[model samples]
Target: MSALFPALVAGSDRPALRLGADTLTYEELAEAAGALAVRIGGAGRVAVWATPTARTAVAVVAALLADVPAIPLNPRTGERELAHILGDSAPSVVLAGAEDVLPAGLAELPRIDVETTVTSFGPVPAAFAFAGGSDASESPALIVYTSGTTGPPKGVVLSSRAIAASLDALEEAWAWTADDVLVHALPLFHVHGLVLGVLGPLRRGGSVRHLGAFSTAGVARELGAGGGTMLFGVPTMYHRIADALADDPALVRALAEARLLVSGSAALPVHDHERITAATGRTVIERYGMTETLMNTSVPLGSHPRPGSVGLPLRGVELRLVEEDGTEMRAYDGESVGEIQVRGPNLFSAYLNRPDATAAAFDGDWFRTGDVAVREPDGYVRIVGRKATDLIKSGGYKIGAGEIENALLDHPAVREAAVTGAPDPDLGERIVAWVVPADAEKPPTAEELADHVAGLLAPHKRPRTVHFLRALPRNDMGKLLKKALPEALHG
Candidate 1:
């Protein structure tokens, strides 16, 4: 309705999006998407095979233009997850990019090709007016499914208003404007790359250059040649960049020249942070949010970074750290850990088709984020871990897996590390460290690693059980697959 990207549909001919050889001007985008909107009109929901391409953008924007809820399907999703999502959302039509080869799970749906370069009949309507009211209960813009780490992925509903509110809040937070050309090779399915990276720029009338695949070379080539100002990545991407920094002067120059380097999806190890900062004298800002909430807090621009904090809350977000017993933790003494609950326009409306799940996610006005963090007295939030996985209770001491993982990463012998809690008869839960050694033939022993951790953190927080591995299992987003590991040790 009134909230449809004004600058985008107003026929501003700026290059709105680019992916390799494909570049679409806002004028051309409106023309292509304007026509697609017509075909998609009256559809309840449209499923998009989300691949990093111009057609993916066009499909999503067109759904917005038509006032239809768009569901983005992860290109890497397994058959089970894909089936569950498709079954739950029940989209009327599934749209795939011209470049996309539809998977067997998607074959059951009525198919539509999301062509980037296509035809338009005439000038697009200035606004998209939804049938019930623009801001009615039925007006869901995007139905994004959760990663379902615990169970089946639930579709999280986000309204156009929420999206606009978040993007506007970010505009003020990061000083994001049309003048800033953004760069990233992040997957188009999630909140980081799509909601913020793609739509945020479109809202500000800026251009986005999506690196088809992430490489330090692609990042270097783009930013080095004045392609983009801001860059976004997950921790793994940044780690790769840090690993190559010594030999890659171009990457160093590009990162240094960029206005901002933002990391999310998981905590970027502090070791990587120091390495990158040491090489380029630029700090990568970390932001915190979830599938339910689009963006909550980010390390504010121009602030002296406090190495391991996600920084202050964004403009409209109201954040609070909640105790395990559901008591509100007003202020942090730095040692008190609590689950994060955020309230704001940035939050999602509900999980589609699951009223029980939706109800459980909320605590009155605020949504329970399930992430554990200790807020600094000055308001900076340092996330310890997720409540379900990373928080470990051992010998009456609560520990975060992240801090231990970071400490292990700093060791020359350790290449990759993941920490979790396993059942123990005496201690209730014992600290377990799964590690990949830098030199497989000469792997560090449990005694050495245990002492190493003891030297850095509290003696009580040291790993009780150390296991060596070839590699730590990770999701597509580079988050450690905590559940993929053994739940408990068998004697």
Candidate 2:
């Protein structure tokens, strides 16, 4: 019922957003987005060519202000996937930068050049105000498509309430305030980058610095002596930071001085966690969430660092671990694994047009996340793996591929590891390890690596087969594409 960004209406001259050398104060951003919002006010929905630029951010903010749902199209998306998303969302117009060369699929739609619209519209009239518009909280704000790993990417419909709830909860959890300046170099399509990275700052009346493209040097420069106070990144970006910390004292200093560093999208390996902590004395915090749910859990500030845990359920979020039969698991012994189900205001309303899929994703009020995790007695959640791909039923035991992968990564000879279950004649399924060795010339023997996992975990957890690979298949977010690995190995 209130403006999502209070600062926009309150009006301030302080810096609000920065992308490279381009900086926009709150007054400038509000006027620009407000003017653009007036032109597209009555549209059914608008598609944003989500690029790592200030213009993309302005367009999304404008759409939100207009109470029109915004669909962020990934620039790097394949033609087929992009077509599928466009057809599913059926946006009234596509908003892009002035110089962007849109794909053929988006050519059919009416286009609004964001930069030109802002400049042409000039200052908004005095009557034009951002009084939360006329939309209800339940009205859709964004329709973000998933990775479509199972099938065609389904558009997950998120509401203004959900966005506001997620950001407010995160603010309380991370101690985020107006004084905090967030810095990141993540793609602007996904929830992690767009919702949390951009909108979070706007809601907090804080500032955000987009790096344009991720680079270790950029991180150091932004977070150096008197720069941004926080850094947000995925595991891949954090891994690069961990790797560079050894030779870059400036990077180490930058990270050390940061108030908060967060990693999400996929689990950050414990090895990289330790390396970064050892180098900078700052422990990186990890949070867990999915497209359906903006944010479910995060390691609260002031809590002791739990290296492998995704911390506790966020405020106003109710989380439960359920057994295979759909009954809730009551124990929190840090061993019994179960699927995570959450009920919260920070949840997507539905999948764009798939009623059957939307109905199947929820168990009454709780949305089944399909992610399996174990809980500590103190209520910390440590994600083991995904229920479908990461859960390996081997020799009558439910083994989590993530734990085994982490164990393999602990070995000095192993550089990257991914574990999966393959059909076996003797056992129902056998544990299989796909690894990229630290040194290709002198790779660790299969027997040696198998024994290494066995020594670290248990005999049953050890991989029955080890396949050395040049690299594991990864998505843009650095999450392992387990389904693509078999094809990659064969190719």
List per-prediction Cα lDDT, in the order shown. Answer: 0.85, 0.89
Candidate 1 similarity to native, TM-score? 0.95
Error of 1 at 206 (Å): 0.5
Q: Candidate 1: worst 10 consecutive residues by lDDT?
A: 129-138
TM-score, per-candidate, Cα-based = 0.95, 0.97
- Tens digits of per-residue lDDT for model 2, 310-414: 999999999999999999999999888899999989999999999999999999989999999899999999998999999989888888898999999999999
Model 2 spans > 4 angstroms off: 116-136
In terms of TM-score, the best-performing candidate is 2
Write down the lDDT that model 1 would get: 0.85
Model 1 Cα shift for residue 302 (angstroms): 0.9
- Compared with the true structure, the alpha-carbon lDDT of candidate 2 equals 0.89
lDDT of 1 by residue, 1-491 (tens): 45446666567778888987789988888777777888998999999988888888888888888888999989999888888998999999998865678889888789888776766455466555233114333469899988888789999999877888788888887899888889999888998888887888888889899998899899998888856899989999999999999999999999999998999988888888999999999989998887789989989988886667899999989999887888998876776788999998888989999999999998898899989998888989998889998898888887887788878877889988889898998888998999889999999999999999989877987899998887777877788887776532221
> After TM-score superposition, what is the CA distance of residue 62 in candidate 1 from its true location, in Å?
0.4
lDDT at position 245, candidate 2:
92
